[model samples]
Target: MPATGFDNTIEVVAVVVVVVVVVVVVVVVVVVVAVGVDVHVVVALVVVIVAAVVVVIVVVVVVVVVVVVVPLVVVVEALVVSNGLWYYPHL
Candidate 1:
């Protein structure tokens, strides 16, 4: 069986939630470490964590757009074109 849009959305939401939870845990850990660590070390660690988080977010967005959004648009376009409900200018 093929996966539906709802399944895809659920998967995406799960991934985002997991990422958020991880970020929160890491932030908490960093805060705890900052009290005992040097300021420069804490800053560097934070920079690295932020960069990693940004990269993860970018990857998730790209995957959602390409894997989910683009295919959904194509499927809807095909359906519309087949039913003669709308003109598909590209084709």
Candidate 2:
């Protein structure tokens, strides 16, 4: 894959994360203001949402590392080896 494609994928992932966080925040605020939910309930809801967001972020990071960074690294390593750029000295 091209570098531009990787850049686009990263941008898309970032946008998705931002959108998810913003939507969660909006929903929580709307529920508090319009529904007048109990304070404890709101707090619990926020906790759950936060945990979910954290999980999402972790998953995305792992995916990007595995899918994008790892492949890129392997490609670069292969290129270096093929070009005889890597150096070794007898010890």
What TM-score quantifies how close candidate 1 is to the native fold? 0.56
How many angstroms is residue 9 displaced in model 1 relative to the true structure, after the best TM-score fit? 17
Q: Write the per-residue lDDT of candidate 1 for residues 1-91, one digit (tens) a residue.
A: 6665554665776687687768767775776676666786667667767876787677678777877788899899889899999986787
- lDDT of prediction 1: 0.74
Give the Cα lDDT of each candidate: 0.74, 0.75
lDDT of 2 by residue, 34-90 (tens): 768788667867786987679687868877786779889989987887788996453
Clash tally, candidates in order: 0, 0
Local error of candidate 1 at residue 15 (angstroms): 17
Which runs of model 1 end up more than 4 angstroms from their true locations?
1-37
List ranges where model 2 is wrong by over 4 Å. Answer: 1-37, 88-91
